[model samples]
Target: MRNVDIVQLSVFVLFLAAVTVVGFLAARWRRGQTLMHLDEWGLGGRGFGTFVTWFLLGGDLYTAYTFIAVPAAVFAGGAMGFWAVPYGAIAYPLVFLIGPRLWSVSHRHGYVTTADFVHGRFGSRALGLAVALTGILAMMPYIALQLVGVQAVLTVMGITGTGPAADLPLFLAFALLAAYTYTSGLRAPALISFVKDTLLYLVVIVAIVYIPARLGGWGNVFDSAEAALSKPDPATGRPSGSLVTNEMTHWAYGTLALGSSLALFIYPHTVTGALAAGRRDVVRRNAAMLPAYSVVLGLLALLGYMALADPGVVAAVREAGNPQLAVPFLFDAAFPAWFAGVAFAAIGVGALVPAAIMSIAASNLFTRNVYTAFLRPDATPEEETRVAQLVSLLVKAGALVFVFAFGRSLAINMQLLGGIWVVQTFPALALGVFTRWFHRWALLAGWAAGMVYGTWTAYLSSSPAQEHFASPLAEIPFLERNGYVALTAFVLNMLVVVALTVAFRAFGVPDGADETSPADYTADAADRLAAPEDPGRALTGEGPR
Candidate 1:
């Protein structure tokens, strides 16, 4: 057993309790007629302005796993881990272009989930179901990684116990998360994000500035990290990593950044955040402004190097045999007890915000696409909202299961695996936003091929620590150079989609009816008055007017 820090635990608990109260109060913050509708519960009544949308999307995308895992990756792998910084930078431009279009269409048509948009656009429930299931599958590990973030902080605070009881603190924290998420729906996270983001920014800014000062400045920190990383690893008989990427590793680094950027906004949670905006301009403005978080991400990644500069932190991490502890341990050792407690609370609350949003997003997909479409086509809006609320709880429970089952391995890899599955939906959801020229059946077939190839390639990837799902990089077929497996699989997915589209057209196969029009993609909130409730009318050439 480890000695728990009483002052730190008390401060952490106080901040957590404060947020728990705020979360429950959010249900009445902006009251709708009732919380019995998906518009209010699943999408926060679709009325968030620029201020709220910025925080919500920032809190959602820059998650606790980001706080813990990115730094941990930097601590373990050196320069390659900085891929997260560039990928984050690249994602926002893509979001700026795609976000407004998706928000406009989703706003006009009352789409609560990406799957709903897919079903309407392609006029193929089968394709919609594929997207829905893939989203749910991808989210499991991602949500679990958030809990792993909390666990790492707890472990650093010496709150751990033996065996099954060790996880009690994690479950208890998530239980609080589930309660408010069920009660307030999207509003819980939207309101709580203010607190989460504020604390996170305060903690990160202080840590970056103060820690570097304490460690003899940034230059010394980098020199120490470089010396540490340049040492040969006994397991691989190679240098752990370097301060810069060389030719041999450049392709892997570039592809990882590019593939991650493509996958970022395609996540159901990000889509949920974008669609919740009050206007199309909210999405665009937030996308243009959200790069501010990327600066914080770069600062956070530098903490890994700072930790390497501190011999105490390095020794503690070596003893724990877990790199995820680097950031938490760094803060704990480098700061006073009260400030360290505040930092811990920041990470913990950071987990709650995104975990709540992700579960809500996943539940929205299930309730709209899976439950209503297949289980109860005639289900009322009230029934749909109720089902979504319950599934949100189940999604949290499933993530808990994932945490226990997977143990506390590398949290970043788990997120990358989720990204691999989520990116497959891009052709259908992201591409479909601008065009329906590709046959719906071909999109379905391509999704299947990408899923199979990505999963198999990830399975074959082995590292010194694990056998399967060991790394996100695999050798690109024919290229013989290692790169992100997701991108390779995505290329295969697109090729299949293109080839099948041509053949199906040549054979005169019937393309599914398109339910969306060009105007729909560009429509603003002002156009909502004329938007169609019945998308099927477009199938009969009676388009929404």
Candidate 2:
């Protein structure tokens, strides 16, 4: 706390203020007929073009947590941390395949949330409600993880302490976030994302290029990391770092990558970004182009090695007792104060973009799925938008409470658990976009089974540092090998869905009607945007307003 640089703090504060102004002013960008409709407030009038979608989705996917935590994972566990690279690569291909279909169907039907699509596709409000609840629950921990990223930067900048003081800056940041997101909805994050992504590219490029030159070289950095990681830790009695995975961890790495990839776009925030695009092609083009961030992520992972090579970063991280601070501390130590502040501001804005989107996504889920589906079936557009705004603020406040109560490590744990829970929604949401053969009841049953199993399994798992929900990986069922618990649960979910679909069909149990047509899945941007809206109502029968 004593080493705070006044110049750096000023720079950081300056950039933050600039972004806050951007957020508040975004409400007027592409101003709609009014901001009362879910289409306007929740999904930015569903009008963002290719370039905007590119930056927005990039900012949403490559979060501050990705910047801070991937390197931190590498710092602590070596080769395992680099699973993010493969995960990012795996994800974009899936995104290219699924994203446009989701956007088209959603745009055609005026679907503001994934659950809205599920409900319409399955003709079952209960299934939609289930998906909505799962999304909100999964998103909270994810939002909390972003706040943890912000807190890490604040901690490194000597702005953190105990009690009320420790959380004051975090609360202030989130308060400002909630304010603009409430006023502008998805528009706020969408506009600020350009700034966030630009700064991120600058900071990441500079850090990767300059820091290694200052340290020694990439060769020495890797050598130092490998050497440091090879030493046995007294707590686990295992070596941490390697250039590649060994026999014991291969399954874990592969499954983690695969599972995380499957879970990535299914998240509400991710889907929100995609669905907010003006055109279906925007989704596809961005999917192809967004892999540029994967390249950045791969380079970013090497920061762990650079941090390992720097004795100052290593010692500081040890004293802080939080590996999440590794990147922030590294930046502070290695860069000039002004440059370091720029980097810190990049990380802070990184957190803000996703946090705003996640809260908005969760709010959409609540307003459409819970409030409209159950509580106020005839709520007007203005009421729906108002409710969503309030919930968005509440969601952000909940995430703040989550970080304060559980601390950073548990926030990480909860995010892993959230990933496990979110992947369960795939069979219902993603598959439904391609096929309606899945029985609605069967899908519901599978979701329930997966949620219960995944949560219980994750809760039982423990790591050296924590007692519950410590890791996303668990022993493969009856295989005596470790793999991502989420993937395992996903398989179980699919099996149950298949078996039940068969049994239900055999018994002649009625499958619900699907409201969507085949051509609806292929709806183009011109058709969707040209469709007329009925004020205070959704596009189709009893859908979300």
Candidate 3:
């Protein structure tokens, strides 16, 4: 492919600068006299209403990972990639049923992190700490996958498209993102998402409609793909892993979409996005509306299939020699160079929006759980904000290691593996939301069993083509009869919790104090303004806001 033009590069840079400005200005947009408080920093002053919550949750859930990886999967495989669309569509109803209650419980009890809620609900600090660590662990790699999304765009526009300085451009983007996020907290990402998602929708729509016409029609485009993929492997005289026959990868990707969507809200960042809403109704409305983004996701994933349909597009992307760059190359070859630049920028911005939010979410967990729990027991609101700011940078730095260490292909796989690891926390975070009677000790063992089982199952699987564990996205590890491991692990987690609860009752194992009641979980509208720490903490030595 030709080198990116100065005009195209300038357009990309211009949009990034616009986003940074938006992020910085958002500090004042949602004006709070004191940005010193954890409430203000971590949750965006908890004042975003229906309209902003639409953008905020839209930004948080449907990230660059959705834009880049989903397309790449569709491009690499086939219809299984479309699983993301249905998963997201179904997630809305799931959230609608559960989200309001989660918001109510979090608000009334002053829980900033899911760990805080678990600890309060079950009266088990060790269990809460485990949940918090799992959240941080799962989120960091997921964030790195977003950074890799930026790299995928850069590889097409710079490193592979141009030459050298490929690394520099992404570094520059991250430096600016980290600066703004550190300065503005969750507000930076929430504010920037409006621009990021708009550009993405526009670019995806144009690519889907325009590319079909340019190639053949939609029918011809798919027909060409079927022919291309059906061809002999040339050397091997066998098709290169037929989508229909590759049951392992297909089941894996499909199940991953289903399981990951379930795990999505369990992530602390997702909860942060939900709780940042000014009203519980805002969350309810967004849950119903957010699936609209899946239309764009389906189109983007189809871009991958479109790439496979046309060999000219494929050969051009091969110059860059990375699968994830397939989307940018397809756009560059099929569309005008200027639009390609805009699409690239859209993906780059898409990456930054979620990366910033994820870093904030993980850092918020660290500050609220670890620092406040064991370190500065008497830290003020201002000090808590400072701690979160520092931890946010460190979380990014940790994710940055994964981004460079594995680059795109492995980073994506790591994100899938990370999902399995993180999904292990779902039993504690999700089930505990509805009940406080699971017995804290049982929940702890369930979490431990899940973490062990999910990791071991993922580790045991490998692909001859990829020469690695192919991840949960590619290989759905099942039992003797076959079933999803993440889902399986979750059942085991629940079974352990239930069995232990029964046994503990027989033996009279003391269930810890239940801090949250049913009424507490179903908080009223007036409960939204409660502080992020429990007032009961003042009675204990847990300090005050």
Candidate 4:
């Protein structure tokens, strides 16, 4: 940007260079006998211990989205935006109960993706394919949210205007993201996470301390937010929009949080981060420790009130021309110049770490589940790796399309829609891990029902602020508008499965054979002796049994 303070720009550049090095060098950190295998290139050889997974999962979940958007929500809405705080709080407990089971089973079977577990457990290629497709599709918009996160920061840092320079800055960002992720695989993002998270913690902690003190105190912060929420809607004279008080908001917000946490671990990208761990315990420890990020989330949401209390932040954000820049503008104007530089880097680097992980996760699904199963069943590991790399590029391109396609509000909704779609995979993929008694055809029927119903319900929801479908629910005559779209779709999915299951059983439709047994789903350690996938074999997908 034309007005960027030279000192802050230098600090920000230093941070960017550091992240680039971490990404490029991550390839060498965990050496596999073969680099081409899905297990190596896609997963970092499945050798990361608790410390690495701690960073990896932390990197995946908290993300640039949490850093930028959550605060932006606070800036726009009020207390209701803080729902993400409770969601993270509720997520770990769910992960604790379910993650170990998935790990135990996947390790036993050498499963590379959640879809792989579905394939072997239910013996249904179609159901496995649905899981893969949902994951890839959901990831497209979710990954784009990270770019949105970067763009929000860039907007504040003077990147966007009515000219070529605005586009140049973003294109440069894309080049850097593509370069690092391509070189490091999962390792690059995981390694970069340490610095990114540290910077985020520093920036948010400083803002929390400085902003509240400058405004007054927590009491004033709450009072200011309540005052804002109490204002009559310009459209409706009533308390317009949401005010996060009492059990109504509580249940809606709480369920949204829990359901999201349940869905989070099952998301292919999140699971991909976990599966790279050296042991199941690492997964467990990270599940517990990662919630520490939630505390920061709570503070970030509170910054909305900080912005509300300060006219300067409001004026600065308005000047920048986007609500997403509220937090960044507050930082630059409120804090000293050097600290603002570091905070900006926090958001920028934060984007790269999650971007890299998402690209890798999407790539793994393509190489292992799609190409191997349908296109070329005889493909080797090397082929799988090559194809995975190609697909990773395409995935990023699709995500870029999404990033450009929507406004911030729509982007948030699309990201939630992505989550809703991904959550539908839970029945076939997550539940299948515990048992295989459900017929494969039943699972497919359930998946189809869930997809159709979830999409339709989302489409039905529309607001003046949003097109297509908005706000997750509408106050309809017959239906309650309070709960999650995913929860409703999941209920419908299960109903279809039960109905079809009984029919399939009475009719004696044979459940195709599962190669894996219950005991096989419980192993956590990798097979050190087995040969890793070669480049040709890896990307094209087919591999040795």
Measured against the true structure, the TM-scores of the candidates, in listed sequence, are 0.97, 0.97, 0.92, 0.92
> Can you tell me which runs of candidate 1 are displaced by over 4 Å?
529-545
Candidate 2, position 381, lDDT: 81
Q: Candidate 2's residue-wise lDDT over 1-545, tens digit each?
A: 65667877898899989999999999999988898788888888888899999988887888876788888888988888888889988988999999999888888777888998899889898899999999998888888888888888878888867788887877887887888999998899999998998898898889988999998988988888888889887687878668678998899899999999999999999999999898888998999999888889999888888888898998998888788988988999999999999999998999899999999999999998899878888888888899999999889888877676564753446577788999999998888889988899999999999999998998898767777677888899888889988999999999999999999999999988787888888898765532345422442344343
C-alpha lDDT (0 to 100) for residue 67 of candidate 4: 73
Per-residue lDDT over 97-154 for candidate 1, one digit per residue giving the tens place of the 0 to 100 score: 8889998877777778898889889889899999999999888889999999988888
Q: What is the lDDT for 522 in model 4?
A: 53
Q: Among these predicted structures, which one has the highest lDDT? A: 1
What's model 1's overall lDDT? Answer: 0.88
Query: Ranking under lDDT, best-scoring first?
Result: 1, 2, 3, 4
lDDT of 3 by residue, 354-391 (tens): 88888888998888778887677677778888999998
Write down the TM-score for model 3.
0.92
lDDT of 4 by residue, 204-253 (tens): 87887787887788788777767766777554566533446564565556
Candidate 4 C-alpha error for residue 207, in Å: 1.9
Residue 48 displacement in candidate 1 (angstroms) = 0.4
| Candidate 2 all-Cα RMSD | 1.9
